[model samples]
Target: MLRFIMQFVIILATLAAGNALSSVFHLPIPGSILGMFLLLLGLLTGVVKLRWVEGVANSHLRHMTLLFIPPVVGLLLNWGAVHIQLWKVLLVLSLSSLCILLGTGYSVELYEKRKRRRNG
Candidate 1:
């Protein structure tokens, strides 16, 4: 449909602009991450309406696991290198995961407490 194409075009253009900016500025951040930040800015500023991309975005979220396929495959292919550092890799992953989980849980609890106070 025309709407679908238009939505994709807008999202892709934002990503392209972010990539261009990152390359031009020589930023260390990956272009894809920059593009996501750009997209978030656009959404917040009303430059990119949520309605325009909501459908496609939701669809992507629904099949989000597909996005990890390439990275997972690459890791598998390079498993020999990873195998040597498996313990170190797992330790780092475990610690990071624990930190993230704790951080998120505390953040949510804080938000809920504030919300309750505000409402009452």
Candidate 2:
């Protein structure tokens, strides 16, 4: 319980920092993207050790799919708006999926190449 609370506090603080930075720069991207980037930077820099919030963070990430529930529901409610842009939406979906697939494949190939180089 305490760990969960701490994790929540950390996430909230990161989000606040991200929002402040975005406002200062007048970024066109969403504050949430900025927050995620800040969190990734913290993780990479060891400023925020994974062990500090590992369990709670893992639990939250495990249930991250639930976060999309509200957005999906809102989309359903606003189906008419989407219907007008169905072709555009489909095009975006196709391109995004293709990008994700290509990125994953490239990352895997890179990882394998690096491993082989290190081992051999």
Candidate 3:
């Protein structure tokens, strides 16, 4: 219990610090993203030992699905607004997914070609 509390506090503190920087600098990017970068930097630099945070992090991961409840609820509630234009939304989603799939495939092919050149 003590370890869980400490790890949770450490994660929240990092998030708060990131939010503070975002507010102070008026950066266009969101604060949570900043906090992620901060956490990554700390981990990479060995300033934050993974053991210190792993407990709480694992707990959050275990219950990650619960996090989507609010957004899913919102979408259901707003179904009427979206239902009118559902066809348009489906078209956009389909086209974008195809584009993304093709782009990812091309990227992987290029990466493999470069890797082969380097290795051989």
Best by TM-score: 3
Residue-level lDDT for 118 in candidate 3 = 100
User: Worst ten-residue run, lDDT, model 1?
Assistant: 79-88
Tens digits of per-residue lDDT for model 1, 1-120: 788888878878878988898899999988878988998998899988899988877776899999899999998999877646668889999999999999999999999999999999
Give the better candidate number (1 or 3) by TM-score. 3
Kindly indicate the candidate among 1 and 2 with the higher lDDT. Answer: 2
How many clashing residue pairs are found in candidate 3?
Answer: 0
Ranking by TM-score: 3, 1, 2
| lDDT by residue for model 3 (29-59), tens | 7888899899999999999999999889988
- The weakest ten consecutive residues by lDDT in model 2 span 79-88
- Let me know the TM-score candidate 1 reaches against the reference structure: 0.69
- Candidates ranked by lDDT: 3, 2, 1
On residues 4-97, what C-alpha lDDT tens digit does candidate 2 reach at each position? 8988889888889889988999999878789989989999999999877677778888999999999999989998786466688899999999
Off by over 4 Å in 1: 81-83, 99-120
Better of 1 and 3 by lDDT: 3
